[model samples]
Target chain A: MSPLAALSAAVRLEVVRLATVRSSAVLLALAAAAGAAGAAALCALAERADIGRSGLLEAVTGGSASGLSVVGIAAALAGALVAAGDARHGAERTALVLVPRRGALLTARTVVVAGWSAALAVASLLAAVAVVVLWPQQQLVAASPGPVVLAAPLLGYVGLVVLHGVAGLALTALLRSAVAAVSLVVAWPLVLEPLLGSVLPPSRWGAVLEGLLPAAAASRLVAAPPVAAGTPWLVGSAVAGGALLAAVSALVLLAAVRGARRDA
Target chain B: MIEALALSKRHGSRPALDDVSFTVPDGVLAALVGPAGAGKSTVLRLAVGLDRGSGAVLFDGEPYSRLPRPAHAVGVVLDPRALHPGRTARGHLRSLAAGAGVPRRRVDEVLEQAGVTGARRSRPQHFRRGAALRLAVAGALLGHPRTLLLDDPLTDLDDDSRAWLLDLLRVHADGGGSVLITASRAADVLAVADELVVLRRGRLAARGPASDLVAGLKAGVLVRASDPGLLAGAILRWGGDVEPCDDGALVVTGLDMAAVGEVARAEGVAVHELSRRTADLDAALLSLELPETELLPGANPGAVPGASAVPA
Candidate 1:
């Protein structure tokens, strides 16, 4: 078989293997549930806001954007968990021994992670839209379906989530420990970003720097689009997030190759 | 065919395998006999390209790493525990076949061949040591590899499983597939081995046909007498080594059974038991377990006489 065919087969096998795990099933279920709940809660809170009749109705009908952050975190965790699962069971050695070429195996893993993340992103978005439509203050605006308004943000959000998964997989390979990889993936956004943000000013430059953080990039994608001045910051954050994901993935892949070779 | 040339592997300052080299021709079963930590596993890993080494491992005529699909070229069972705990026996075989681009039907064939078809749906955690080893072997054979590199494949097997495995290996070798197996004990698998490559501290001590190596060891006679000490002394005086056997008997090496019997009869020692004990694979292995320093010409700095020599 051709190399590409072999890689595809390998990735498909990995997906099946990961799907059968109890941990992957639990994590995916939690992420979907959190996304749905967050959407409902955000829509309820938006209906209570006294901004204006039209604004309040519109807000309530659009579902809470806050759920995006939880979904992002959950997606990141899922990615990390999937990548770290192999190391936990010592399956990485088997994979490497069979495949031999470290780069091919890493590529297959990244592809599987990205594919799963995309599916989750779409499912969560649809669930949130359904919840928003069922809100009490729902009104049909010119953008009734919310697809045109949400398409770009959804893509960006999903991209950010996929980046987290890739980064998690890479880190897990480098660390060779699932607990450490998952902790680092979750803590970087929840703990480290806030501390770093406190030290930097809240100006344009500071916002750009913050966007480089994994959490900020994910939030910038899903957060309600800024009215006038914050557009540039959102764009910059998206770009920086993408860059960080690529850079970290590359670095982790290199480390994984070295470790696999050294261990072998 | 498989070849390991000048392979040297060191864990820290201690040498696990120091400049060990050997080759197995196609369609032959070669047994690597060594004690634990004698670099047997290291040699298997290097041959399968699972572990890196300073020397090269060639398959057929090319390096193992350069094979298009290495699984199809060299099947290896390095560790039985390398399988995923969550995957069932069948699932694991299917995954391995998929990764190697082998036909899905091959999975069932292998499972049946390994006699694990009844437990195909069972998870690997539920498998006993023998079952796990069979699964490992089945996985390795999924791609119909030309060469099999197995390390201690008979470690935890019962007599029935060992006999089945021996038959399987013999069949594979007869089908023009080379087999290289390393084992701490040689009693079970040695009968089928065409070549015996003995390793001492990661270096090749001897390489030849198994029969030749066994025959070259000193002849011996199994003798039983009431006064074993006197019989041993008489045997020793005849330039022979006496190995105490169970039931108060002595296996005297370096002397024929008739000569030993004659000596015992002449010395008025009762010859209750008298039989020739040909040096088997076990005896040959014992003779090959020389000091590590002796394998290398200049490994030991101190030139102490007889220190590096092992009594045969």
Candidate 2:
């Protein structure tokens, strides 16, 4: 078979691997549930304020939402499960036998994981939209932005989710342990990065240093215009976000290919 | 044909495999026999490109890494645990089938052939070691490759499964495919193997046709006579060595069964039993384990057709 055809077959195989595994389905359900709960809490807070819930729902759909944190976390875990789980189960050897060229297998896995993350992000957004449009207030339905207006932000949200998932995959492949990768993915963003950002003084140099952190740059990438203006520490521009995303995507593919080649 | 050219591997400061080279021609069933930790598994791993080593393995003429689709060229079963515990038997086969780009129906075919069709939906955690091995074998056959590289696959199998698997391997070789299996003993593969490669301490001990190697092993005779003392003296006078057993039977070396009978009759001894005792092939093979120089000189050049290859 031609190399391109071989790679294409490998991609299909990876799709089957993800689809047939029950853990992937469970992860998707958990991400959806977390997204719904977060969206609901934000809606309650918006309703309590005098301005009402539509603005919050608009922001939730527009990529500046906070409740989707769990979705990203779930996506990351899903990636780890695929990479580290295969190694633990001895499926890695079988996969290499099927596709001897490590690069082709890595490419196929990355493409499938990115596609899975995008589908998951889209599902979460749709669920949030359904909740808003069906609410008794009905203002969100009337005030919803046109597709043209929502396209970039929606794409941004999908990109963020994909990056998070790929990062988990890359780290797990490099470390060769699911537990180690999981701890770092969770602790680094929620605890370590925030603590580091706070330790730095409120100065230009400190902002630049803080902005170099992945989560910081990721947050700035999709922060709403008003939120970006108000938050002093969110120093990363859209360019920084793009750079971070590219770096993460490249890191995942490289780590997977290199690690696979080095080991079995 | 599969050719392993001077394969060598080192783990830290210890040598796991040292310059082991052999070939399994088409239509041959070959066994790589050695004691535990003699690098039988390492050779298979290197053959399939699961590990990098000092030498090269060629399937027909192409290395495993260069094969466009390796599964379609060589089937491998390095470890039974290679199957995912969570996936059902059929699910695992289906995954491999998808990767090999074979028809999904081929999964059912291999499952049936491997005799695990009844447990198709059962996960591996629920399977016995024998059942899981059958599943692994099924997965290996998914691509119907021309050559098979099986690493100690017979270890955990039951008698019935072992018989069935041996037959399957023999049939594959008979049908013009090649099979290379690894075992810690000769008896396991002697029934079907056309070629045998023996390893000792990660180095080549012997490599030749199975028949020639087995023929070169020492053979003795067992005798039980009413006049045991008379028979022993007569056998000793005839230049035969005798060792008495607890059961009053005498094990005579350097004499064929017919010769022992002739001596007993000439001495007017009553012979209750006279039987040929074949040398323990496994023990004889182990006895052949010596440094390459020492091994060759001690071997029987006449008994073994390829004396050089048999360390004889």
Candidate 3:
């Protein structure tokens, strides 16, 4: 097989790999379930707490105002499992020679992991709609998903899932251990970065901090009360976030190319 | 042909391999045999581009990386950890086959070839050590590569399985495909290889035709006398290479059994025991796998390596 063809095959093989590993399969299922459940809880809360909660459609599509965004956390986890699991298992020893150039192989893995996260995002979205719609309408005041629900929020959700998934893959490649990589993914964005965002002075720099922080930026895309709606800062944050994604991608490629060239 | 030229490796300060070079010609199954830590694995890793070292490993005069589809060029089975714990034998091979663009049916083909078809559905983590090793070899053969680079392939195999693997290797070699198998004790494949590369403490000790090296090079005779020290001296003085074996016997090389007996008779030494001794690879392995204190007296310690050890 040609190198590029071999790489395409590698991606297909990776998907099969992701599917067959019982733990990964279970993790994906749990991620979808958690996302669905979180969205349902938020939809129920939005019915009563109409002021901050927006409406039922918004609540189901976008997550609750407080705590973690379910899709962000779920997608990040799916990314970690897909990207880091193979490296943790030393599967590359057999895999590297099959594709030889690790650039193609790692690129394929990142793409496949992002694709899986995207699928999870779609599933979570469907699951939320299912929960909110299936619930007794007598209990919820604004249970109806208005016509405006899927368009703008769908774009944001897709973007958030993709970005978080990419970050998971890049971080895993940087660390090279699944447990360490997954811990870094969970701790940095969820715990440390958010803590920093809260503690930092409320200034233009704080806005920038909120914009550039991976967790904040990713969560901003899908949060209930959208931060600084349609402002230049959100645009700037998206650009900065994109730039960070680019930097992380460069690092992932660098780690794969340079690391593969050296000792395994 | 496969050639490793001027390969050298170091882990911090200690050398792993030094200026090691050898070739495995077409239709030949070459054995890389040495004691533990003799850099056999290092050579295999460097050859397959899994590890980077000072030199180049060429396949048919091309560096290993330039092959584009390396799996099709060289099938590699280096370690048991090479297989994923969660992946079934079939899943592992099927995925590898996909990457190499080989037919999906080739998975079963290789499974059958490697003798793991019966357990193909089971996760390798649940497999017996021998079965797991076979599953890995099945993955290696998935690409149907022209060369096979195996590291310690015989580690957990019974004699029959080992013989079965050798038969497969013999067929591969007969088809003009070379196999470079790395092992600490290589007696199983020793008689089958066309060439032998003997390494010691990360340096090339010897490399030649297997027949020449395994014959007079390794085979020797042992003699037990009233005084092994005196018998050893007599053999040494009478133009024989003698080493003091802790078995209270003298291991005599560089001379036949008759010559050893003639020397003992001339020296008026009382011969308590005299026998032709051929070193078993298992015995050599005992010397390696055990601690120094648990070893056969002078079996590995203060002992000359390679051909000086008789092989049966």
Winner by DockQ = 3
User: Could you tell which candidate, 1 or 3, scores higher by DockQ?
Assistant: 3
Model 3 RMSD in angstroms: 5.5
Model 2 achieves a DockQ score of 0.48
Where does the lowest 10-residue lDDT sum fall in candidate 3 chain A? A138-147
**Interface RMSD, model 2, angstroms:** 1.8
Report backbone clashes per prediction.
0, 1, 4
Candidate 2 — which residues are off by over 4 angstroms? A1-3, A50-68, A138-150, A198-202, A227-237, A246-250, A253-261, B221-238, B241-252, B255-277, B297-307, B310-312
Tens-place lDDT digits, model 3, residues B216-277:
33467988987777778878888888877767888887899999888889888889888998
Q: lDDT of candidate 1 vs native?
A: 0.70
- Candidate 2 C-alpha RMSD relative to the actual structure: 4.4
Q: In candidate 2, what are the lDDT values of residues A1-264, reduced to their tens digit?
A: 466866887897888788767787787777666656656655665567543323543435433343136667777787888898678888878887777766777778878888888777777777776665556573544444455444455566778788778877888888877777767877876788788889999999998777767777666555444432433423335566666777787777679667654648
Q: Candidate 3 at B181: error in angstroms?
A: 1.1
Best-matching candidate per lDDT: 2
Q: Give TM-scores for every candidate, taking all chains together and pairing residue i with residue i.
A: 0.84, 0.86, 0.84
**Residue B226 error, candidate 3, Å:** 3.7
Docking band of candidate 1: acceptable
Task: Give the distance in Å from residue B72's predicted Cα in candidate 1 to where it truly belongs.
Answer: 2.5
Give per-residue CA lDDT, model 1, range B1-312, as digits (tens).
Answer: 888788888888888888777789999999988767778888877765667668887889777656778788888887787666667788888777767778889999999999999999888886788898899999899888989888898987887778888898899899998999988876656588988777777777667677655444455688889789898888888787788977788988778878888778877888888888764656545544546444332332211121122221
Candidate 2 per-residue C-alpha lDDT over B84-198 given as tens digits, one digit per residue, 9 for 90 to 100: 6667788888888899888999999999999989999888876877888888889889988999988887886899889988999999999999999999888888888999898
Candidate 1 runs further than 4 Å off: A1-9, A19-24, A44-70, A134-146, A199-207, A228-234, B218-230, B236-251, B254-280, B283-289, B292-312
Given candidate 1, what's the lDDT at residue A75?
60
**DockQ, candidate no. 3:** 0.53
| C-alpha RMSD (angstroms) for model 1 | 5.3
